[model samples]
Target: MDRALELAARGPAHGPNPRVGCVILAPATPGIPGRTVLGEGWHRGAGTPHAEVAALADARARGHDTRGATAVVTLEPCHHTGRTGPCTRALLDAGITDVVHALADPGVTSGGGADHLRAHGVHVTAGPRSAAALDLVHTWHHAVTTGRPWITLKTATSLDGRVAASDGTSQWITGPQARAHAHAIRAQVDAIAVTTGTALADDPALTARTPTGTLAPHQPLRVVIGHRDLPADHRLLHDGPPPLHLRTHDVGDVLAALHHHEIRHLLVEGGPALAGALLAADVVDELHAYIAPVLLGDGPPAIPPYGITTLATAPRWHTTTTHRLGDDILLIARRTATHPDPDTEEA
Candidate 1:
């Protein structure tokens, strides 16, 4: 199970598919209680061979007999044919006898894999090392279950929750460590989004850069949300990849378009209005705030008031995690279980 978890962790940082790992163990020989590991493999992304099939192929290449072998996998073997063939069929064809899976596949079309394996007479053990497997595909699960991308609102603010000074001079608000951390977050998302206000004000490239300022090898798609066209010479247009222009103010419309593009995780680096709109639409899945130890009493608010007039009506978050990065503090928060609308707030 630990090997399976490790292989699952090697998957891409961001993509539309879930990360999965698999290990094949030959039956225990004689008095030895432990089985010999015959092969190991992990899924890279969509359109790739599944972990089970990869491991089975590796075992075959090494001249290891797979008959009566146990397949230990992080997630349940998929039973539906997607970009690749069904993993359940692969396991059966490989002559795998027993299966140990961490998490059940939650996908609507690819779920119930454990049942199919049992129907085929394969002994199955579910939920072995489940917590780690679930964390491996946290956002992917949310996207598959909700039919929309998981949105994370990321912001750099002052101690008093100010995003900029009174004059709108917001450069270098956080130290190098905090900025680097933010860039790392950008690298792990399918797309980076901002509003027209930010695009015009900052002219941000929206491309993830390494700590040394070079562009990252795998860049997220850059998107600007609003009804107006950007300036002819906007830097984002000439960056690593051309920016995707979404001419709309409706958060639902923006999310729908991204969903169609198969974006699983979206990182919103805000200007206030767009953040307010996402919050008001109640589509935000997580908040990543980097708060520096400074006060800008007269600057623009980090988030504009969106009908949050009374204390009782203010938004609340749960499971906040705090980390100190240089002179800044990174605060991550997720919506509580009691929060309305697990799926679009039932509008």
Candidate 2:
């Protein structure tokens, strides 16, 4: 399972399909405590062979007799055929006797593989390193399950939660290390988004770059929100991937638009207005804050109030990690529990 996950990370960071990996193990012998590894493979991207099939093909190419082998995979082997044949069929054809997988596919079109495999008489075991496996593809799974884009909100603030000083200068709220770490976050997602007010005020290029200031191999799409138009001399108009203008005030609309653009994970770096709106809409999946040691008591807060009047009404988040980046402290968290279902709520 560990090797499968490592292989899964080798696939593209953004694509229509979730990254998956598979490893085939030769049947156990009388004296051997563990089976020998036959082959390993991972799903490259859309329109490619799935991890199970890829691993099977690799085993055959190596002249290994895979009869009664065990298949260990990061994700459940897919049961249905889309761009490729069913991985269940491939595993059966390869004479795989047992299967072990991490997470169950939540996708409507790609789920139910475990049950299908079990019904066909293959021994299936689930839940090995499931949490870690989910973390690798959480954004993809969320997008698929909800039919919308997954949002990761990033903020840089002072100890007082102020985003800027009285002069409206926020260029150095956090130290260089925290800023560099934020850029690394920008490089991993499908898009980096900000409101038009932020774009105009900061004039940020929003390009992820190496420590040497060169562009990273994976550049996220630059997205600007709000109904306002960008100036002709704007840096966003001329930097990195072309800027996508989402002229809307509705948070749901913004996510729907991004979803159509193949944006599974969107990193939002907008200001208070947009942040508060996302919070009120309950659409933010992850919240990342780089808190500096300085106090800025007079400027706008990093997040403004958006109708939360009590503790019960306020959003809940669970801390995932806390790291000290140079002089700043970074807080990484995910939403703990969403609002109760409308049908289940009391009057």
Candidate 3:
């Protein structure tokens, strides 16, 4: 599971393909009951090597024979051919006999890796820690299958779900811990996007600046939605990393532009209107709501204008994970398979 989680961390950095982690487990003798982790490998950098191949090499280096060993992975290996050879071939070559996976690869180019392995006399089991693994690469997976990047609507709001004070003073609604966690999310995704309205209103840096005063060298691309021209002095645009100016009227166009940029994962750090627009367009794939325990009844609502008509009409999502960051509750939700009416416009 640790290997799987670590593998997921590789995705945004490696474009097009989701990062994977693998571990080879060798059964212990009578003296040692639990299986020993013989070797572990993660996709290190862009175009390096696949996770399974790396893990096998590690096992060999450690003098651990992988013949008949059990391999645990975060996602199913690739069955079809790609830039790298099929992972199924590598596993077979490594003499791995058993496989455990968290989730199946949803890509058309690599869907049946597990089936291919089973056909080749490998025992495969799936769905153990699958949800957690999927959560990590949810955006990437969504993009591969849907032809657009997955959108995560993230906001820091008060206990009453207000994003700002009544007078529009919205700085630091959540504590330090929640802000730190948000930065981590920004680092993981391909782009940190917001609307031009948000850019004008907040003038946020949008770059993932860590608490240690260190900036992520390859910070996510900052994108501003909408066709409105940004001010020459826009803080987000003038920062160290240049922001992408996307002139689009609709959320779908924004998503298409992001896809063109090879941004498989997008974090929407909002100003409500953008969030509501994405949700209304049914383009949002996941939501990360940071609910701080405070109340400001007259403040701006977490989401903007369009009142979600009904629970049924609302885009269906599944709660993937909920963690506590300081006094804030971080809730993560993924889009469901069903799509409501794509033709309907938001009120």
RMSD each, Å: 4.8, 4.7, 5.9
* Clashing residue pairs in candidate 2 (N, C-alpha, C atoms within 3 angstroms): none
Name the TM-score of candidate 2: 0.88
What tens-digit string does per-residue lDDT give for candidate 1 at 59-106?
988999999999999999999997899999999998999999998898
Alpha-carbon lDDT of model 2 = 0.89
Candidate 1: list runs displaced more than 4 Å: 338-347
lDDT of each: 0.89, 0.89, 0.82
Model 1 scores what on Cα lDDT? 0.89
> Candidate 2: where is the Cα deviation over 4 Å?
12-14, 30-32, 81-85, 119-121, 338-347
- My TM-score estimates for the predictions, one after another, are 0.93, 0.88, 0.75
**Residue 184, candidate 2: how far off, in angstroms?**
0.7
Q: What's the lDDT for candidate 3? A: 0.82
